[model samples]
Target: MKKILPAILLALLFILTASSVGYAADIQMKVDGVTILAEVKPEMKNNRMMVPLRVISENVGANVHWSGTEVALTKNDRKIVLTLNSDKAVFNGKTVLLDAKPYLKDNRLFVPLRFLAQSFGCTVNYSHTTVSVDTKPFYIDGVQVAAVQEEIQMTMGSIVDELQGHAYIETMYNLLMQNKGNEVEAPARISLNVHNRLPGDYDQVVQIDFVGENGDSITSFGLYAEVPSEGEDEGEPKVVIYAETEKRWYAFSSKASQEIWELNAIAGKNGFLTMISNTTP
Candidate 1:
């Protein structure tokens, strides 16, 4: 009787496990409006959602590292550490308890969804078996800017004249425009330093500061370029631009103005100093 009972219990457990596995495939996960097609879908454990660690982390711009049974995630100034099968995690060097611990499943590290989302400074929403994660805000010198899907395009001449008084901007602009095709090369990512207080125009005005890849201070500005898509033979090449701020990095292009120039200025006692001055002749 004991042997028969044990066999029946093992069979029932296998059936339950198989059912849960099937349900895991049905759970949907979205990050910042993009759907995540994880190799191993998320599953529920004790009513908590657990997701694949690397898949979600990289998607949200977090760096992931693994050492033995420990996993570490670093994003911006925050760091998170989690150990296998342990309900404890270290967030930014502070130990915190987890509702559902991380574990290894199907050769992938699965972590608690809510804990991971909150740790990365993202907001989480769960409904109807779908999990949505909105990444933390991008900041610039403590001020929050509205997220835009397009990038601003400025020519070398316009950027140089607008930042005429600034030595750093002048030097960088000269270096960037030295070569004939330099502007067409990869545009340098830059941060802005805005001075003065102006209502409703804060987002448009900023002093440009460019930093080179080697951490050396350089000057450059982003411009739009159109590149042909793969397998495309004719038609217009898609325009793209790469622009970065202190808080966020954007790779976008505007459809309205492919080669348009607009004048910008700052109100001063004497008159107005040109901010976004002239364009290419």
Candidate 2:
């Protein structure tokens, strides 16, 4: 009777745990080391782990759109289309099969997490109640990008900003990648002994730092708009890009400079923080 009683208690505990696994609010999703506080938590269906599709995909820098019940995810030149209640998904122009069908629960679309991670060149690991996703870093000229920084000199004082998240960081990187400038010689340094200089000569409009996991800046590029130059566009006051790692300078493309200034215009509006949802541990 004693052995039978112990077995019955164990079975009861197993039943309780099994019932909760299907839908539990304690489940968490972490991207690039930051916990995501989502309105609808993770769930298990047909023995597969399901996650909120838009919440997970957008955080990884993908653009998600929907047409009726069909959803399309675009990122890094790759596209994926998923239909509700269908196991088929179009991946990069190729139709493929998903492990489970997508469904709506509590007004949120849920899909298998594995398919979303792999399609975006990310690594995923599921353990206990948490799903961790690590995305690939941005790179330019064979150099890895770490973070984006901005500084503006206003009449009152100086305004500084540090940017985070894929929207800001990735957008900046893509802009730079699209606009490659002409290589040029480095500019002169600021010194009181100099005969004559302008405020623009002594200050950089903004700078971006590429940092690694060690917290050390691998490389930093500064955008100089007021520096004196012998180039043809002297009167126009062209922007200059100085690469610290290479110790070289490049003429900032005119179009790119315009976009950068536009980006600078809003750097201090509310600080350059990105879309951060409720965060869990």
Candidate 3:
């Protein structure tokens, strides 16, 4: 995975280093004289400029596959594959020898970006502040649909609401909005464990809320919890909620703290509640 510094820090670093480093002039080439737009990131080092090969390749509707030993570039109707450690490259059935070897610096693999871009009939352009690649748009999956591979474990529990079955887990309240704005409010239901830490009657209340990708409020629901024990002022155990929808948000809150903090905003909405032990004779 490419290590990403915070955007602000990365920008600042580039500015501080730019003056002492040589820069590349913007140059654009075309495949069959067709123009395409691309975003370029460049670096100046040792009185020379360097660009990422993968970035240039992929920007021009080409795919780059590297397995730590070999690299391959492929696109519809064309293919370029090569192996490293032996100074060999193959372009569309034409084998060629490299005058120099590709090496890694600061964990990034560096190669001749211009050569790769031109090999695919694409043009690369660079200004003092930007690099642009122009290539035929390639067909691939949109980034929004990719599945997230991060693993997060969630704890689940349930608390009975009322004696004699007077109360039960409520159905998720569906709150419809008329404006159809990005934000919506909806009810949430989750099973929770009910146990009082101290000997006494206690009650707990929980709430849920959803935050969308744009950092907008979507939906929120409040839950009421009842237990039998004394509540703890410090380190009181509480429940957190996790949503399991496609591209959903993972919501989190704590009744122990009596304040809600978002656990995972990238997932669907979620919430939590505080419970004090309730004692009943």
The TM-scores of all predictions, comma-separated, are: 0.47, 0.61, 0.33
CA displacement after TM-score superposition, residue 56 of candidate 3 (Å): 2.5
Q: Give a tens-digit lDDT track for model 1, residues 125-229.
A: 987768888775433344332221112333332333322112112222333233223113342423232233222221222233443324343333344333333
Question: What is the descending TM-score order?
Answer: 2, 1, 3
Candidate 1: deviation at residue 187, Å? 12
Distance from true location, Cα of 222 in model 3, Å: 36
Candidate 2 lDDT (Cα, 0 to 1): 0.70
Q: Would you list the C-alpha lDDT of every candidate in the order shown?
A: 0.54, 0.70, 0.39
lDDT of 2 by residue, 1-281 (tens): 99999999999999998778543657787776666656677777777879888666756767789999999989878898999999999998899999999999888899988888888888899888888878887655555655565555443444555665444467676666566578976666632223455544644665676554455676667777655554445555666787777788888776787776565443323234442222222
Candidate 3 local lDDT, 1-281, one digit each (tens):
24555777888888866744433434332222222232444554443345555444533445678776788888655677656544567888888775444556555565665566667766666554554445533211221111111211113333222100000011111111111123222224332333212333222343333333343434443432323234545354333232323223222233322322221120111111222223332
In candidate 2, which residue ranges exceed 4 Å CA deviation? 1-23, 151-161, 164-168, 176-208, 212-281
| lDDT of prediction 1 | 0.54
RMSD of each: 17.0, 8.6, 18.8
The alpha-carbon deviation from the true structure for residue 38 of candidate 1, after best TM-score superposition, in angstroms, is 2.2
Q: Say which prediction, candidate 2 or candidate 3, comes out ahead on lDDT.
A: 2
